[model samples]
Target: MLNFPLWKKLMVGVVLVWSVLAALPNVLTPAQMENMPSFMPSKTINLGLDLQGGAHLVLQVDMETALKQSYEKMEDDVRAALRDRSSGTRINYRGLRSNTETGIHFTVLNPADVPTVKEKLHSALTGVFVLNEGTNIAVAYTPEELTKMRKHALEQTLEILRMRVDEFGVSEPLIQRQGDDRVIIELPGVTDVSRAKDIIGRTAQLTFHLVDESARAGHRLPAGTGVFYELIKDEAGTVLDKVPYFLVKRPALTGENLNNASSAFDQYGNPVVSITFDSRGTRKFGDMTKENVGRRMAIVLDGNVYSAPVLREPILGGKAQISGNFTVTEANDLSTVLRAGALPAPISIIEERTVGPSLGADSIEAGRIAVVYGFIAVLILMAIFYGGFGMAANVALLFNVALILSVMTFLGATLTLPGIAGIVLTIGMAVDANVLIFERIREETQRGLSPMLAIDTGFRSAFLTILDANITTLIAAVVMFGMGSGPIKGFALTLSVGILASMFTAILVTRWQILAWLMRARPKTLKA
Candidate 1:
C-alpha cells in the first residue's frame, strides 16, 4: 500500500490538496488569493478587546421592571373582565414580602365587588401564579417565584442581545447574562463604545395612541398612569423649542419580525435602510392602521420620535422604508437594531478599559528578538551534537516554519503576542521530533543496516515517540484553554494550531524532501 504507483499517489495528493483548499478558508487564511473578488473574504484582522480597545459594559437590566409590567398587565386583565367598574376603584401591591403585614387588597365602588375579585384574580394569574386562600384573598407572589421569572427573562434577553450584536456586525463580541439582574457585554474593535451603548441601551419600542384631547395638552397623566412620550432634542444650529410632542400606547409594536434591514441608495443617492418584516408583523401592522387611515403614527426609538408619518393607506406588505437624517453607515446601524427587535430593558454602562497601540508594538518587537535568539541557540546545539544528518534535520526545521505561517495565513487568525510565543516554542519542538528520528537512524545504521534501510527504519521506529510527546503537549494546551481567560485562550489556540502544522511539516513535508533528495542525489552511505 505504501509503495503505490506514482500517478495513483499523486492523484491522492491532488485530491487531498483540493479538499484542504476547499475547506481551508474556514480554518486557514492563505488558501485564497488576494486581488481577486470571487471568494476572498475581507482579510481584516480581529483584534482582541485589550488590543483594539472597545466597550466593556457591566449593566444591570432591571428584571423588576418586567415584573411590575407583568403584574400591571394582570391587574388590567382583571379590571376589564369585571365589565363595568363600580364607579371608583383602588388597588395596591402588598408585595410578596409584605404578605405577612398587609395582603393584596382591592376596594371597589361597592364592597359587593369583593367576592368576584377572588374569581377574577384566580383566572388571570394562572401560569406559575400561586394564590393563598384565606378569609381574604391574598394575591401575593413568592420571592423564589420572582427569582425564577427573572432568570427566565434574563436568559431570554441575553440570547436576544446576541442576535442584536450579530446584526450590529461587531467582529468578536462577548454577551452573556450574569446572575439574575445584570448582563456583561464586551465588544472588540468598536472605536466608539458610546454609540454602541446608546443603541443597546434603547428600548426601540413603537406604539400608537391618540392625543388625549379636550384638556391640558402637555399635562402628565395621574400618578399611577404613565404618559408615553416621543422625546426629542435639537442640534446646535437648529431651534430646540419648536420640537413637538406626541403620545404612544405602552403596547409596543416590536421590530423582532424584521428579517432584513440594509442601507440602500434612493434615486437621488440619499441613504435609507430598506426594511422588511415577517408575516405576522405585516398582518398586525396592516390591521392596526386599516381603521385609522389618515391619522399620524410615530416611529419611536430610544424615547425619541424619529418620524411621524400619516397613514395614507394600509401597508399590507411586509416591506417599508425607514427614511431619516442619515448617512449610509448610520442608516445601516439603525436598520440592524430594527431587524433585531427591541431590548427588554434599557441598559446602563458601569465599567470600561482600553489598551494602547504603542504597548502592543513594543511587545511584538520583544517577542521577535526572543524567537530569533532561541532559534539560533537550538541550531548551534543540534549542529555540535550530530555533525552531518543534523544539517539534513535543519532543513526540516525551515519546513516547519513555512508550514506554521502557511496555516495561519490560510486560517485568517489574528496574530497575538501570545500566539507568537506559541509559534516560537513550536519551532523548537519541531526539531525534537527530527532529533529522535535522526538518532534512531544512526542506531539502526550502526547495527549493520544499509543507508536506505537505516533511514526507513528510523522514521518507522521514531513515529510513536514523536506522537506521544506532541499528544501530551496538545492535551495540556486544551486544558489551559478551558481554565484560562482571554490572553491564555489565545495562547492555547495558537499552540494547538502550531502543533498540527508542525506535525505535518516534521513528518510528511520533511520525508518528502528527504526522499526526493535521496533518489536524485543518491548518497552512498550513512553520514553518522
Candidate 2:
C-alpha cells in the first residue's frame, strides 16, 4: 500500500492541479473571468433559486376551453363526413352545433338518410359514441377516451412549458406538475417577472381565415362567419382602439403547420415576425390565396386578429411576415412562442411570488460564515490532536473541498443553502478516516513494530472499514436524490460529491504524503 509509482504520482499531481484551477473561477469576478487566459478553466457553479432570487408561479390549465375546442373540431369533421362525395351520395343535415356539455348535435333532414349518416360518422370518428333519437343525433367522447385526452393535454403542456423556459435562458429552473390541473414553476435569476409570465402564459394559437368584405360592423353577420377584433396599440403598447372584422368561422390553416419563426425588421424599420411553413401549410396557403385573389385574409392569434392584408397576388414560397407595429421586445417574444409551439390548453396564473436579491445575499453570507467557522474548528482540532499527521490531514481536507467545488462546476450543479450545510457536514467527516488510520498506526507501534511496517499495516487494515462506511453513506445520498424534491436534491447532490472527494483525499492523498515523508526523514520512532 505504501508503494508509489511514477505514473501514480503524476496522476495525483494532475488531479490536484486541475481541481485547483477549475475551482479558482468561483472566487473571481465576472470581469476577471472575461480577462482570463484562453486556456484556463472559467466555468463556475450555478446558484439555486433560493440562493439567487427569482420568480415563482403557479398556473392553472383551462380544461373547459380545451374540451370546447375539441368538440368544435369534431363538429367540423362531422360536416365534412356528411358532405363527402366518395360514395356518390350526400347526407342532408341541419342544426349542426357543438358544446362542451352536450357534445356535437345535429339532425338529418330526411329520415331515410339517418342510418347512412350514423354509419359515415361512426366510421369517420374514433373514440366517440354516436346516439340518435329518431332523426336527431348526438355524438360524444367515451369516458375512457375523455380521461386519456385530459392526461395527454396536461403532459403536452408541461413539455411545451419546459421548452419555453429553456429558450428563455434560465440557469436552473424548476418546473413540474403540482396537481391535476396546475403547474409550479421556479425560474432562477429571472428579474423581469412580467416578461417571463407573458412568455409562459400566452397560448399562441395562430389561425388564418378569410375576411367577409360584404358584411359591415353594425349589420348582422352572415351565416358561417364570426366577428373578431384587432386591437390597435400605441407606441408604449397601451390599447388605443379595437377594429371589428367579420371572418369565416373555419380556419384555412393553423400554427401546427409552422416550421420556424424569427423576429425581423420590415422595410420601414419597424419590428415584425417572419414565419415559415411546412410543405402541407405551403400548399394550403397557396391554394387559398390563389382561389381568393381579390379578397382579404385575416391572421388571428389567441382569438384576436393581428393582421388582415389583401391578397393582391398568390404567395407560394411557404414564407410570410406579420407586421403589427410591435416593439422589438414584443416581436421577439412572439417569435419565441411561435417557435416553442402552442399549449394544448390555455393557462392562467393563480399564484405568483418574486424573490429579491437582498434576501439571497443575506442567505449566502450566512452560509459562508457557517462553512468558515466549521472549517476552522475542524482544522484546529485535527492539528492539536494528531500533530504532524493531523496537519497532513488538514491539507488533504482543503483539497477535498476544492474537489467538491470543481466537480459541481463541471456538472453545472446548482448550490443552495442546504448544499452549504452538506459541505459543512463534509468538513467534519473528512478527517474521520485519517484519525482511524493514525490510531491504528499508534497501536501497531506500541506492539513493538517499526514505524514503516506499522504505517503499512494500519493503512491495509483500515481500508476496508473506510470503504464500508463511505459506501453506506453514498447509498443514502443516492436514495435522497432519487426520492426528494428540489431543495433536498441539492443537499443530496453536494453530500454525494463531497463523500467521493473526501475518500480520495483522506485515503490516497494523505497516505502518499506520509510515505514520502517517511522516505525522507527515516524516523526511528512513530508518534501518530
Which structure among the candidates has the greatest TM-score?
A: 2
TM-score of each candidate structure, all chains considered together:
0.69, 0.88
**Cα lDDT for residue 224, candidate 2:** 83
Candidate of highest lDDT: 2
Model 2 lDDT tens row, 1-528: 889899988998888888999999997998998898989998889988778899989999999899999998998899899999787777888899898987999889899988888898899999999999999999999999889888888999999999899889987798988768889898988989999999999999999999988888778888989999999999988999999989998898899999999999999999999999999999988898899998999999999999999999999998999888899999999999999999999999999988878888888999999999999999999999989998999999999999999999999999998999999999888899998999999899999999999999999999999999999999999999988877898999999999999999999889989999999999999874
Expressed as tens digits, the lDDT of each residue in 482-527 for candidate 1 is 8875568778877887787667656765566566666777777876
Q: What lDDT is obtained when candidate 1 is compared to the true structure?
A: 0.64
CA deviation > 4 Å runs, candidate 2: 4-7, 30-37, 107-115, 131-138, 142-148, 172-184, 214-221, 265-269, 442-454, 522-524
RMSD of 1: 6.4
lDDT against the true structure, per candidate, is: 0.64, 0.91
